[model samples]
Target chain A: MQIVLAIVIGAAFGAVLDRIGATNPTVISGMLTLRRIRLMKTILLAIGTGSILMFAGQMAGLVDVGHMSVKTAYVGVFIGGLLLGAGWAASGYCPGTGVCAAASGRKDALFFVAGGLLGAAAYMATYPAWKASGLLDGIAGGKVTLGAVPGSKFDGLFAISGDLLGIVLGAVFVLVAFVLPDNLTGGKTPAEVPAE
Target chain B: MTLDWKLGGVLLGLVFFAAVLLVKPIGVSTQFVILNGIVTDVVNPEFITQTDEGYTSTNAYMAKSNGKYAKNAANPVNYSFIFVLAMMAGAALSAFGRGLDREDKRLPAIWKANFGDTPWKRYAVAFLGGFIVLYGARLAGGCTSGHMMSGMMQTALSGYIFAAGAFLAAIPTAMMLYKEG
Candidate 1:
């Protein structure tokens, strides 16, 4: 039953991603280069919308907070994030979008996927060394939410309810998405390219 | 017709909401880990059980119990795997419906324009990038979707911090590589 639902939801998510031009490497790279803002707007809007919905759901008791899979913060995560960023700039596809791009018939994306899997395998192969390297050892906070802070849910950082803070941030993202020009810095829109 | 991203974002949020409501948070990195486990199991059955020091297994997550991979509640071939497959199917369907599937260009225009027409260079860079991304994602315990999106939704501190790191690196790295030529 759960498997069937996953399939349905996954398809819907993929379709949305593709529709938003995420499956196109040019758009992705363009966003990174500041040559285009459409994809950026889309991403910000999606994240913002998701953030609002999630917190709202939690507040309304419609969603289980425990179901949220929060990752642990560590020095390695920060360093690894930098590496991932460099990789994203070079390749133009992140893990999820690479799969979606491949499915959309991008041959290069297939190679990207192969590279990712091989990289993952390599990590597993060298797990022992990495584990002992102390890079994975220092964990800052594990599974902590804004609500966990004292005084108020969002009092720690910005001095508001954590959930409200998320919503406000989300609103800001959406606002930016709206305010930004379609071609902020001007670049070839996907429509300008001849269909292959 | 291009779908409005705002609409897409809203719809995606709803899908995510429904997903969390019905099953669990959405993520793709773990699927790779599970795939590696399955491949390793097939190549050398004992490799998975072997420990880093022979006393403690290097990958306890891949350990089997009663002839089944016992870490995640949903087996590799089950939930996450199927979800990935469905994502592919959905992308393909969308492409087909929009008549965008006819394009057979093996390389993206921007890549070819800036990096030159060589296929090998493109492939090597892509492969290296993919490898590094996955390695980083694994080390960090999640990818953009798993940590940045889902975690941030719940107002988790880790999510914000990770996002900060990702953008902090990604923007400059991109600028360095694809600088105006």
Candidate 2:
């Protein structure tokens, strides 16, 4: 039953990612460079919107706090994020987007997948060193949420209601997506592209 | 036809919301490690072995989590792995269904403008980029999906912190590489 759901859910997620032009390297590159933000706007809006819904669902009793999975906080995760960002800009794809792009017939994405697997293997080969480095040790009350929910095992960083916090943040993203212009760097819009 | 960008965002959010609400949060990068484990097990049979307790791996990392990782590697036909496979299928269906992602125009326009059309170079860069991203993701214990996107949605502090670190590096990196654009 879960496997069937995974397929349906994964497909819907991938289809939506492709439809939103996430599978396109150009748009991703454009967004990162601030040359174009059509995709960035979409991303902010999506994240924001998702935040609102999930939190709202939680408030409405439709979402369960127990199901919420909080990743452990550690120094290495922060450091790793910096490294991930550089790669994202250079490659124009994150793990999920990269997979989707490859699946979308982008031959380059195939290489991306290969590289990712190799990278994972590399990490696996050296996981002990990192673990020993103390970077993986719990930080900032590891596995904590911003607000205490009624039932989750994770701690809360603040006494404020997490659900409320999510809605506000999400609304801000949606607002930015609306107000932000299509192009930030004055790149050639589709209409402005020189004819071949 | 491709959905409008804003609408696409809403839909994407809804999908994520549904996933989180119904099951677990939507994450994919961990599967990369599982993939590596599976392949590693193939080359070195002793890399992973079944035991009375359950599956175990010679590698300490896999052996952690009480052999859960090792179990998944030994039996790759699990939920998350299958989800990843399905994600690819979904993208293929979307891209190929419309026949829109044609081969000839594979190289994106901005890339052409910045770095002439050299397929191999792009491929190499992509490969390097993928390697770096995955390595970092593993170090961070999540990727854009698991960390940035899902983390932020759940209002986890690490999510915000990770987003900061990511953009702090991403903007400069993008600016450095995409000078032409």
Q: What is the C-alpha RMSD of each candidate to the true structure, in Å?
A: 4.3, 2.2
A104-195: candidate 2 lDDT, tens digit per residue: 77878888889988888888889999999999998989998888766677788888777787799889988999998887767564432212
Q: Could you tell me how far off, in angstroms, the CA of residue B57 lies in candidate 2 after the best superposition?
A: 1.1
Give lDDT tens digits, candidate 1, residues A1-196: 9788978999998888878777777777767777666777777777778777766777777767556655666667777777777788788888988888888878778888999999887776776676678777645445566654232223233345666676777788778878887665565543432243
- RMSD over all Cα atoms, model 2: 2.2
lDDT of 2 by residue, B1-181 (tens): 5577778989988988888887888889999989888888899999999999998898887888889989998988887888888988898898787665354236656567778888888889889999989999989989888988899888888888788888889888887887664
Give candidate 1's error at residue A82 in angstroms. 0.9
**How high is the CA lDDT of each candidate model?**
0.71, 0.83
TM-score of each: 0.86, 0.94
Clashes of 2: 0
- lDDT at B88 for candidate 2? 85
lDDT of residue B73 for candidate 2: 86
Assess the local accuracy of residue B90 in candidate 1 as a C-alpha lDDT between 0 and 100. Answer: 94
